[model samples]
Target: MPTSHCAYDTRLLVITLILLRGARAYTWSFKEAPSQCGQSTVAVAGNDGTPPFHILIAPFGPSPLPNGIETRQILDIPFTGNQSEVQFQLTYPTGSQFIAVVSDASGFASGGTGVATMVTNSTDNSCFDATSTVQFDFVFNIFPTVAQVVQCQNLRISTPNFLGIIPGGQSFVIPEGTITTDASTGTGFSYQANLRAGTTFLLMGGDVRGNGTGGSVTYIVALGNNDGSCLSNNSPSSTPGSPAGATSSSSSPSSTSGSSAGGSVPTET
Candidate 1:
């Protein structure tokens, strides 16, 4: 019978390709909503002999929760324009609430044109010059029992004594979003960078050029580790050399008289 009708049409085309591959199997789940999740590591710095700049990160969710996620994009760390310094990592779940808007506005990603400067903190030109984009609207809980905050001040030196010659010790605040322990606290030249939980450490400082004069400056702070390295206090550092532009040699005196600001500027890679 014609070879049994060509073996029943190859067994009905292998049962219609196994039912179309089980109807294009697809499954995804990320449940744990009670409120309070944490993770935010956004660092952007570029604008020195520019020619390459591109770092865009978008993660939005202002209202609508409970399930139907809206405005989702938890990753987009792109920078090939030459790259000065860029870091991006965001993960906030448990009733989520995010607004991480970092931008280069498409200057150079192997394309053309570039200009940036938005290091927000860690004083060193205090960057905000030739801006592009920078937004961080954070609110994380991460399931109760999560308190890792470091807020140390005294960065007010328009130029004088260069802040007592910069020398703070034991400032280890390493925990850039990933939970860990080994805490430390304030001391010496204004130190206060503690970490108990983890995932939030990027307190880089700068202002290099210490030859002496009114511009004799030197401020350094460090505490950023995820494998890149930079504990800074107990030993283990990197990223500390690129403040440039200091050739005054003589002309010091312009202090509102505010000292105590040292230790914690480690992210120069």
Candidate 2:
């Protein structure tokens, strides 16, 4: 009887510890980004009740332990049956590996603390021409809130390889008469950019904090314009030569009334 009681107590202790730890278990993996020049696809799986999470990609290091400079938040991943995948199609300038960290909505509230994985890379500097102009759009669907001023902030753009934030002012803007609203399901905001080809870039869109929620979400996608074809997943070897002086850009939203919430945009200190 004593032995059985001891064993039961141990089991209870273990269960209690696990419960105390909270429900946090996730597995993240990557595959080649759809475009040859773009970054890779990140697939994340949560142990039930992990949906509605936030995944951040940043340069690997200690300074950015939970969240720091060079961090791009891929916001509001929907609850697709305990698993969801997001694809990044940004070109890395020369050498850059992306580190990913995920936090459920609850975890994000207390600061970005959750599961993290090894660095992943999809480097391809020669995606286009350095001198040429490539027009693309940044579309984001951030979580919703009831606050009157539901907005997103800290819209930053950066070069691949985690070099540093682009210095020039925003070369684009959100349309004057566009529909940027806040809905529980999600809200969409669009911005246009005229980036130099062959250069890789990332846009870090943040969620508005004052409005309601925590952590923001954004995605980097290549617009299929007639200027050049959006390259599918292929090896750089397949292409001939690379572009020279490939750079990237970062732009903050002109206004605060955009999407979900907002926070301080991470920049090289």
Candidate 3:
């Protein structure tokens, strides 16, 4: 009886240790903007073992306007993590409609890696009447030691029209040696380009089909060396590029309008 009890105690101790290890390995925190239309800044520690951060954004409340012309919310999420992959899993309530507006005419700068996965419910009511009026601009300043390679991948977009806002748009300036691949099976888009040190890449476009909600979109932008190792890694070879910043542009789309929520927008040259 004594031997059996000793063995049971040992097993219990092992299990407790495992649980504690898991708790330490993964740690996350929650934050919200003062209002739905405000900007939110998420700061992540570099080389931390924490999993991808999750952001829960509430849906827009009932609009006071009878026509619902100004019934929209603007959210600008700027991530600041050095030598770390800035990743976020965003969740929105049903009937929530929003668009990725171009806040800066120039574009946001990247610290070599930026990734976001957004999940929301679909709604017929969009912020815009037509896709032509909607535009998205993503400009990244890539600073690398060697010939750095930047790859942008559109893993999944729920609405086919949203693909127009991706890199393949007309305003996009593809640098030399850039290889663009259109997915043969689905409505996916991807591009790989080699950028010299201290050069900027511009990706801007408008979709003819209006942007609606109800599904999800997964987009990934990563910078790495020729050997294919992510520059976001915390190794000696990992060249920590400059941090990316997103600023609001003066030009606003006439189709959609909203007031800023007073969140500080990070700015990088």
lDDT of 1 at 242: 29
Q: What ranking of all candidate models by lDDT puts the best one first?
A: 2, 3, 1
Every model's TM-score: 0.20, 0.29, 0.21
TM-score, model 3 to reference: 0.21
Write one digit per residue (lDDT tens) for candidate 3, span 1-269.
01112222322221010111112222222122111222223333334343323222212222223343332322334334322223333323222323321211122211112111121222322333322221123212222211222443222211122211221111122322323333432232333332222222222221332222221121223443333332232211112342111111111112221221111111122
The CA lDDT of each predicted structure is 0.22, 0.28, 0.24
Model 1, span 1-269: residue lDDT tens: 01112222322221010101112121111111111222222223323224333332222222123333332233335446655444333332222222122234432111110111111111122212222222212211111111222223222112111111111111122223323322231111323332221222222222232211111111233223423222334331221342211111111112211111112111111
Per-residue alpha-carbon lDDT of model 2 for 118-217, expressed as tens digits? 2222234355343432221232332221211111221222211111111111111122223445443333443333333332222333323211122232
Off by over 4 Å in 3: 1-101, 104-190, 193-206, 210-216, 219-269
Q: After superposition, how far is residue 6 of candidate 3 from its true place, in Å?
A: 50
Model 3, total clashes: 6
Q: What's the CA error at residue 202 for candidate 1, in Å?
A: 10
Candidate closest to the true structure, highest lDDT: 2
Ranking by TM-score: 2, 3, 1
Measure candidate 3: CA RMSD: 19.1
